[model samples]
Target chain A: MTFRRDRVAALAVAALTAGLLAGCSDDEPDATPTGDGPSASATGTPSPSETAPVDRSREVVDGAAPLEEIGTTTGASGSSFRGATFTFYRLDASPTSTLLVWTMTGGGGSNPQDANYLSWELYPRMVVDDTEYRVLTYSRQGEDDTEVPGAVSNPVLRLTDGTESSPQSALFPPLPDDVDEVELKSPWFDNLTLPVSRPG
Target chain B: MRTAAATLAALALTATPTVAGATEAPPLPTVEDVPVLAQTWVGNVNDDRLAVLSVHGLRRIDGGTVLYYSMGTPQDALGDRATFSAYGNGNTYVFPQGTNTLCAAAAVDAEQGLAYGALAASTPTGCLSTGIVDFATTAEDPERAPVAHVVLAEVPDDVDVVDVFVASQLVQGVPVEDGPLEPTVEEAAPAVGTGWPSVDAAEVAEADDSRSVFDLQSRVKDLSEDVTTTQDGEQQELDLDASVLFATDEARLTSRARSVIADAAEQIEAAGTSGTITVTGHTDSNASDSYNLDLSQRRARAVGRALEQRLPDGITVRTEGKGEAEPIADNGTAEGRALNRRVTITLPS
Candidate 1:
């Protein structure tokens, strides 16, 4: 797999270099096309207005989609916490990762609660074969090459009429490939079994 | 042109995804016309190498908030290298849930007379991930404009917007769009601190055997370079350069060192009252251990006496010296040696 990817990358580079050489040979006086060597005019202060047009298209490539949506739970899978209703909407799985999506509906009665009022530490987890896999947290490399974890993405969800719902998702380590079923657990919801779907 | 060539060379390594007939890549969501919540420019506006960072998406996940922004140079041929570097090296300050005040991150060579002193100080935690959307050259389009680098940061929940301090410029009030933004990676873990429940590393290792486990440590520094303070929630250690405090190996405080010690006294007083301040002096591995220890002890005593006189009543000041035994930086280099030659005043929170 790695060899194939490398070959594709090499071919792409060759093609791009050839195209660049062909394009620059037409009008650029300073364009010194030496196969894959540096462009002579790269350091020249070319005005922004006189620069080339940008290609915004994202080309599709192969072997990129390593994960697929393999299974999901049926029916209204949700749990309530405080004054909010959290509904599990979707789940996408791969061999090494899982993406779980849900929605949080505000339950504004006399007392109202939104996303801001909730604690971010309350993460959902999945239990496969009695083994629990917690929702993964995001981390980045810090000073002195330390891995600093515990960064979260919390979008502001304001509840005006108590019916407003906001989409939420969490990524987790994957379940076993052959596992047919697993149980989902969250702070706001009870443990519920979800059947794994293997689509051809 | 060397930079452009280098960028293309680097891009070529990852450009395989652009090749056709490879396994089908996941379809990226169509670029939406998301409203820019906040925007700021890194580096001097007049500088040709300037980059613009604008917030476009913000969403809440189970345990944190994710912010998406576009960081890129506006002009063609000016690669996103500087912009990406600035963002990578920058720090994100978030107003954690229910708090209107921003916690200040310690900065190196921070501008004098900034409002950071007014805000409470805390180590900010967030993970920054960048994706190169487009890399264009002047040859591609006479305009040579490149696509902006897409940056996503996961911060603590309740962070509606964030103040990014990158390349010595603080861009504040960058509002987050309350919408969905796809993450570049599938699996991400929360930062170590910020009150999140701890995960079982053994269990996590079993699930994802390939995950790299890291030692988590939170060290927040003060804004000054000469006189810096590092805190880890429990204790705050203020390190004052011995060179600034004394002349060479001398134990006596210089006239300029008097003011520096005075400022540290004020900080110590402001931090709290009645806490025991342990003043420990360190030295580089230049001289013998005994000689260095004696010098460090004298230096610690001098700073301790100065602090004792300035601090309010009921506060105790103790002094000691480790003398090249506990060097924070490498002593082999001159810069590291200078860092090692310092007096540290530790105060418990």
Candidate 2:
């Protein structure tokens, strides 16, 4: 009986050791290249070639520049209620409507509902030639009678290390031809003067 | 065999990282740290729950003023759950300059999650009927006192301060700040939720087609067990309980009904101009519609005649019956059915 128990215990210990070694072996490939290991050169040579084909599936699609591009005008920033800063990135204008692309940053540690307040509740108006224009509603592409009014898209852009940013775009009524500058009236802030760069 | 077992156990222990000494998390900040323009404490006597409501500020958003307020519990308070229902729905109102009192279409809290807003898009009227803000203690951090943001939309512009009526107590001269309250470190990443539908411009345009913004008043008061009153700027409706006015299945007035009608007539005489007063009778979802209609019509006429006799000439009284229709409360409960069966006297503007 003593002999049989000793054999069983040895087998159990051997199995536990093997399991631990297997776990370590599974993580070796990832950690090897980062550490000063002798196998680093052997494994590093083939990694780029192996990953090249797999990376194609995740590459940006052809003709993707237009989809990511914003308006023609840029370089304007202003502050609004609750210490939120707005950096206008792009401004695209057509005959029927004007699109303003901007990023909202700051306002750290606020309630998430504050994002909703800034997006849907607050309407930013633009004044051109002393005529104030409101946000124009637009129907979703290919969906009739489903109008989405102009507002920020996301509810919250967490302020982490004061670097978090929320990208937003709002549509407004059309601007007249050769309009060089306009005043923006956001919530609590009466005037944010921005120069418009007309499309060539 | 014992040596082999001991070696395996030591190997297993070495594989896992050692835990550092356990340290307690820092405590959450108390509600006193928040900057508030106006605040009031409300207690629920039945549940022993106390809540603090503070108005932070008002900002002009999208041609309407957005009123921002915070609802929270003081540190060490007995009750952690704070909601708009605690102050009673329709009890809160904002009076802007020149515009009539604006009742909140809906009150939303961040803790309910974003599904509430997506759901509100489908049923606009149901969302408009009840405005609720519910805040409960989170399981992950029970020590953190629950605080929720409450917003009321469509307040008229240029009003610096307004009177807020909550829990039957009037708070006058509450200052309205020009901008929103400064963001606090403790409030970072409050849970995301759907906004009130009325704040959405598209939804507002759609709802406006069916119901006017001026018609969204819900100030109601119950004077006694048998009498209730609803008032807006333009109209006033007084409801008299049918059980107090008539016997079951009968249109004849009870002996005590005369004093009630007399009091209503006196109020009408004082408040009404030389205009037509409408006395409408409603019934709960009981008995046949035709039978209920006949009974209601008789009851309205009886009350109308009683009012006409008490008032001097010049006020015109019109009587109508809307049986089993236009129920103000749900008919799923006994109390709701009792409330539905009533005669309403609407004084003209």
Query: Each candidate: RMSD to true structure?
Result: 24.7, 27.9
What level of docking quality does candidate 2 show?
A: incorrect
lDDT of 1 by residue, B175-218 (tens): 43332332111112111110111122122222311121211112
List runs of model 1 lying over 4 Å from the truth.
Answer: A1-200, B1-32, B37-54, B71-154, B158-160, B165-172, B176-179, B182-238, B252-263, B270-272, B288-294, B325-339
TM-score of each: 0.37, 0.38
TM-score of 1: 0.37
Q: Which one wins on TM-score?
A: 2
lDDT of each: 0.40, 0.40
Report the Cα lDDT for candidate 2: 0.40
lDDT of 1 at B122: 17
Label model 1 with its docking quality class: incorrect
lDDT of 2 by residue, B1-349 (tens): 1121122233234433322221211111222223334344333212223344444344433333334443433333423333323332111211111111113222111111000111112231122222322233343433232223322444443444543333312222344434323221122112211111113334433432121122212222333434555432345678898988999988999998998888787777777557788999988878888988888899999999988899878988999998876555435435446767899998876
